[model samples]
Target: MTVTVESRPTGHPGYSQTLPREPESAAIARKLVRTALAAWYLEDLVEDAETVITELVSNAVDHARLESIRVVVTRPTEKLVRFGVVDRSRNVPYMRTDSNGDNTRGRGLLLVDALTDRWGTDRYRWGKQVWGEMKCD
Candidate 1:
């Protein structure tokens, strides 16, 4: 895994890591999120951010065709932080409306929706990025 810190126009540094698209990569992504939040003194958002990243990474690992995916952590503002997973697959993620009480799968996005202030997907020519944002204050 290679981690890189880049300066964003918002004056906050964004951290990203490219990791193999495997279930184990979710742990690494969570650690990256924790480290970045610690450095920014946004520790309060750590738990939700970690959960959001894990779900995003898990979805990518299961559905994306690429061998690798990118995990991104960015502070869009002093009071908000965003977590994103970028994959080569253009398929967008959505919450399954057909999920029932006994179903174990397809609930990740529901958890993400409940935890995040807002979440959405950004489509690009190459792929799509699924992201969730939480408020710090």
Candidate 2:
């Protein structure tokens, strides 16, 4: 996967990092979300944000056949922070309901969509970015 460092916000402080596309990276992603929220304006919702980020990153790493992952945290203002993960797979993430009593899988996007204030995906040339915004106010 291609890792690119985009310019930070002109005034708002934020962070971006490249991580290996693996399940282990989920823990690191959670930490990154917690740190970003603490450093930005979403401290009150850091726990929820961390949980959402961890699930999304874990799903991407486990499902998307990508070599690397890119995570970006940006505070567009003081009320909200956006956390996103971009991978190198073209498959779009989806949320599915489990009806066969199987609880071992297929709930990441559902949890993310249910938890975040707003979330969506943007398609890239080679992959897509699944992003969510958590509100602090």
Candidate 3:
């Protein structure tokens, strides 16, 4: 809910976007992230991070059926970037691998889980925060 545009650069490019939790919101958030961090150290990782953010936001939009999503990004250092998407969903997202090649829509988190250094979900009073971390040294 807060977007702090601080000057202290710790490789931390943070932005919080509250938007109607829809498919388009994911794309919006991705663009916002690229703009916010275009001057930071992880410019190369922006695309990957955007993809992850899109997947997380899209998941919430499609399955959670929520009204809004808030995204936050924090980079502790130049080598790591942690990001999360907050949504009004109580159900924790899980990865479902399709072995029979019959499922096409269940691989978002799987990609996130595979690409990130770590990823998890935390509970909030009205919803949950799904987060993941990427490294770019």
What TM-scores do the predictions have? 0.88, 0.83, 0.82
Cα lDDT over the full model 2: 0.78
lDDT of 1 by residue, 1-137 (tens): 99896532332469899999999999999999998888877778788888899999999999888899999998888677889999999988988777588978778899889899999999999999999988876
Using lDDT, rank the candidates from best to worst: 1, 3, 2
Residue lDDT tens for model 2, 54-135: 8878878886776889887877665667888988888888777765485667777888888888898989888888999876
Spell out the clash pairs found in candidate 1.
none
lDDT of 3 at 64: 74
Off by over 4 Å in 3: 1-8, 11-13
Better of 1 and 2 by TM-score: 1
lDDT of 3 at 11: 51
CA lDDT of each prediction against the hidden true structure:
0.88, 0.78, 0.79
Please, what's the RMSD in Å of model 2? 8.7
- Model 3 worst lDDT window (10 residues): 6-15
Candidate 2 clash pair list: none
